[model samples]
Target: MRIPVLAAVLATAASLCSAVPANAAAVWEPCDPAPLQCTSVAVPLDHARPHGAQVSLRVSRLPAGRPADRRGTLVLIPSGPGNTGVARPVTLNLPPEVRDVYDVVSFDPRGLGGSTLASCELSLADLGGLNPWPAPDGGISANVATARRVAAACAGNGGDLVRSISSRTEVDDLDRIRAALGERRISYWGISYGAYVGAAYATRYPGRTDRVVLDSLGDPDPDRLARGWLANTAVGAEDRFADFARWAVAQGMAPDAAAARELFLSAAARLDRSPREWVTGNTLREALRGLNTDAGLPRLGQLVRVASGGPLPAPPQPPPAAALQNLAAVATATICNDVAWPRPVEDYRRGVADNRARYPLTAGMPANITPCAFWPYPPHQPIRITDRGPSNVLLVQNLRDQATPYAGALRMREALGRRAVLVSVDAGGHGSYRSSGNACGDAAVTRYLLTGTRPATDVLCR
Candidate 1:
């Protein structure tokens, strides 16, 4: 899975079963799931150069809560084709059905948590400024320079570890992880970008998979891969914005169906010249950039309200330093490693111009060039997303997700063909299994995970 970088961007439980003895000091460990143990698994730094070197991946397992007779290993592949979430074993509180029947497993991919790390050493400012959201007039100058700087930084600091972070390598490592755990067939629960990692694994190691649940999918088209993922933000943004708009109107923007868009833009334009003083040099547009983030879901109309004829919403405080950097690094590496981006600054300029003209709501953030454009290395292998896997896949999507839009999810649905079933949540948010808004959608996914039973046809939970 790729770390969601602005661009950096579940649960359940049951178990009175005496708390399993926990790993001490645990800082995080290399562990194997089942036999209900934790241990380290090592993979070559560069697989092709086997004896060259190696890195440890943290792995862990939480056993099933049901019939003592084990079913299969169910790995909760964490997001970020690059965040070391190997600690998931200790973090998640899953349903008893999940714990008792299958060994719930997950690992920090090679070179990730508990494993070695590759850092760009980006300063906090650079991290905050990576996802160039153009100026109100849609400027791209600063964004372009930042992109190159980031690319160069990665090239300089990434080291040998960067070379091994590919989707294929990850699948291979997963296989090795499964082997080390002594499981022949494993099941998967992948959310967001985890869906990509899971799909790649199933495609490469079909016989090794039993049941799979992919949530918030991106288009599997390789060439257009992350670009597709990036662009979907516009769709996602628009979808949520519309929701916000409707809510705004409902809140008396006008005649039930408010058309107070002019007011919002007027406020933005007003702030463009005289930005509100939430912080130094950061204006309303810049503040809105925070809203453009993953958690800045569309329902923010509650915050986007106009005051004194100005749409000056109170901005939230920025996140912590370490939290921001690690997340940012993971997203940048995953995106950069996965594919090469458009290089011609002119291409990005034109793309941004076009996108701004077409989808002013996203302000050209999606179409604008990223560090991927100047990535130091090309993708290890061409992206290949075939519908050749088994038919045991289940996809659950929300009609409107701020990060992975419904349209992209549809493309994934098409890519999988008969190999998958889709469940659409009738809500507007990114968290699919349970957004706290769609119980039906949540129940459907939970059912599939617990019983391996899926709907005959794609169903919309309204």
Candidate 2:
């Protein structure tokens, strides 16, 4: 039975003395006075200390057009550990069948958008000045100092709430949202980092999970977690770069794929030795990331052509300080909180050495050190993903995703075992479902979401 609003308030008052009512029926109001509705969800700051403090998550809903066909709500989890979800439905590519039967819901994770906010209070210089990519020479001497200082800044300004932003913490928050909605079970559609969150939620609360879909799956290695994700990018980028090289040759930008690859590598090295316009080592890496997709390849080709020979182009404008600060704070907090990275400087040094030798295209950036190595607070142990939960998961992956490659997703697929059915799309890029151009992959996901059907065996979308 739904608790009365007054009873909900009294229950919350008894527990946390917070004004937020416990599991109160959401008082939905028009977000734009259109069809979209919005509300705030109150959850504990620390699930371990439920009565201590609280935070509010901004939640939005696009109610199903055909109520008669509506089966349940489908929550869309955004990609970045720092990406806000509350505004995602506006741009999400939802199939008509799925949209007709589900109220699409999303929320801004803690420390983001309308939620209880925290910032690292970092300077714009520090935000843009620091590069996640290590030196092209593979010397991480400067990176060590920067990682330490950045970690310290986050800890100093982020407060306790930042320390608690993690996949496990987010699972608790998800459950709280489910409870607040008065739903017995909730469907989930999570992409990239959100896939890890969805997996953790299913592992922790399998009974409450329904029609779960994990797109662009991340490595589920508990000990390594984000460390593995960062390192795997070297291989992922090399695989995706081949596609771009082929595209460049076909577009007449280069004589052939091999020549194109060599030219790109030379350009990266030249930029590293003497910065030209916006073509610094960091920007080169960022440009390659964009080059992984069809939609982005044309722009990448233009950049490459100019870089080969031309006047130095102007540096692109950096993001506003506030946006950068928020992103740095949230991304740093989430990864650092999930698990500790190896603290020894020599470990990263050795790893970078190996990566540079093995994957020159990536230039060892994937194995480089990050602020997580210097995070002050001890992190919770990561959840070991296994085939112990309900068999209700659908994994959609691209063959060559730059951020979450096929190799890493294979581990996730193996770990899920009988618990999931995977649709391996023969495509290149980070995401698969609606983003991948393959009709087979899109149809598979849409069919699964609409009818709860799974192939008897894993299928490759060709």
Candidate 3:
């Protein structure tokens, strides 16, 4: 979801669990911090040769209250082929019901957080500034060029760590951690790209799972996996963007949302013919290209606020190296290893032209060519998404999520067969349950996790 860079790789980094002790592969080390505890476990850096090399993984836990209430451990696997979701347990603001039943456990996967770290020696300019978005006026030449540059920088500088950091490896590493923890099975909550990890883990080791939730899913279609998500982003962006447009018009600008939407489209169209230069250095056309979804519109509103003489949205900050590394990892491993992108520049040009005509809101970003176009290597194995898993899996999703839209989530629902139930929330955001508003949503999920029971059928949360 949203390229899995955030949950996938950002999870690669984390803070010490102050209250826990750092015993080598020991269970429940008590740290000094009152709220949390931490420890380190060792796992093979490469699963293929598990006994060959070891990497230290940091684990944090907030012990369940009352020994009697504690049922098992809840492991949170983050998104992205690279997202570092180590700190999720501390950050989840878990419901008291869940807290009493499970020792919330989490760890940064290898190559992220306290495990080994990898930094691409990319230039500051390449790392920072507004992200390269396709032109709103239907020009993707800049984005195309930028993708090549970024991919080249990563391939040239990314070391062995990049090569080994993959979805399959992370899942194997997770199983090893579960064994080291001495837990017979683990309850898992995987969001966005994490859903794919959870699916993979569940499929590969069906018996090892207790309760699993795949929040936002990436298609298990090995052939399209990441590429499909990237291509379909335009639909998500357009859907969510319309929501914001309605909200903006009803609450502020231009009276009714219907009119505001037209205005928004007109503004973008105007930029196509004559772009207005912004303080951000990119023209409005360029900004529109980058601002594909609701995730990006808040910042763009600031620009509109200024142009309209209202309060300008604060200028956006560029991503630092720490974040870019994760983004690069998701783009590289998934895009490079997934279905090959077309080679001739003309192929991209034609696709972009076709997509832009069909879906203008996202321009061609969802279908745009990436550096994977020039990938130097082929996949080590064909991708596979398995439906075989525990029937307790629950998928909670927003109707409109730019990063991972409803359509993708539906595909996941079908793939899981009766093994999972879908809870569609009437919300608009990237994540669901705890992140999105609605107690009904939070309560339903919490009940399932705490009791191992779920709704009889797919239910809508509104």
Candidate 4:
């Protein structure tokens, strides 16, 4: 999936919160609308060298409405390696109960939002190269060239700060934030990629976490890391497409679900042979992977109809060039710096061929090689998630998430073992709690968050 970069900048503060010691008093100022406070914490550029060069990370908080009822702090970790959480405190539609009990907090990781920005200064073409979509004929020559070019650009342009972006550094930064807040222990609500971060934090500092929630978790296997997550998308896309096909059939796009699948495959193959306007086989495949949610069904159906000789839809407005570049730089640095990807182009060639034959909807894009394969530096020590933490963690996942998927969530659950309980929702989408509209799942999560209670065993919500 192509992750979008959120570059929202809060209004300038009358006075900035200068960096202070982790235990020093936190100086929060009114940076956004009323009731939202912002601050910056100075963290070492490299966690290992605590006395060396440092960078500041912007943090935001929405104080609890009833301070007397305050339980503790709740940190909302952002999703993408490129996504920022500083604005989430005011932007997310958090439940009133949650807002009343705990102070909601979020932050821009080292290389995002109002923290310290990092860029590769890559051209728009190179930024697009970050996604390894194979050619129409399932060839990898173009992909290989783009991957090498993007990797070289990042290594040359992105400085030490960019190279320092990884889950391990992020966990260190989070502990500093916790210390800055003066909270002996903190609760967490992390989604998507943030789930991995949260898992790593819980594993590293199990004693510091009170109540933890991991939503839409990916595989926590250290050996594969992001590589395994990417490859698993092939299965995720095929599973989610079944839901889309049923929706298309109900919308009268085809006589039945099987016909809808046939129509989509045929249209994609036709576009591969001859492009229609800006629509190509790879573009359509990416669109399907993105539009797997119920809310996205209508737009996806329209795209399919257009591909089947209907009128073309208006093109989407592009994001700012700088935003795109920052996203590509940070995502590439994080994924590549987190683990070692296979370097042989032949590995991707064979994998893509097999993936395309097995899952035509994705067209082998998920298995295709990325800039990570050609990254300049080797990965640092990896964080291994195990069942060594407290039993304070809770996991919520959708049955069919096109990005993280159910299979990966199962792996996470298995890894966590007795330390966590799984709340699986029988649904087709990306997120579950407070997103999929599954009341059962929502109640279980909310109850756990409020009362610190969890299911004795894994529970399925339908």
User: By lDDT, who's the top model here?
Assistant: 4
What is the C-alpha lDDT profile of model 1 across 110-197, one tens digit per residue? 5455544455667666787876777666788888788888877766655556545776677777777777677778888887788988
Residue 387 C-alpha lDDT in model 2: 91
Model 3 poorest ten-residue lDDT run = 15-24
Question: Cα deviation in Å at residue 169, candidate 4?
Answer: 0.9
In order of appearance, the predictions have TM-scores of: 0.83, 0.93, 0.84, 0.95
The sequence of per-residue lDDT tens digits that candidate 4 reaches over residues 174-201 is 9999998999999989998999999999
Q: How many backbone clashes does candidate 4 have?
A: 0
Q: So what's the TM-score on candidate 4? A: 0.95
Give a tens-digit lDDT track for model 2, residues 46-147.
Answer: 888877667777788888879998999899986788888887766788887788899889888887776666577666656764556777688888788778
Candidate 3 lDDT tens digits, 80-151: 656666567777767877888788887776656655555445566655521435665557687677667766
Best by TM-score: 4
Query: Against the true structure, candidate 1 has what lDDT?
Result: 0.67
lDDT of each: 0.67, 0.81, 0.67, 0.85
Candidate 4 — which residues are off by over 4 angstroms? 1-17, 33-35
Q: Give residue 177's lDDT in candidate 4 (0 to 100).
A: 93
User: What is the full ranking by TM-score, best candidate first?
Assistant: 4, 2, 3, 1
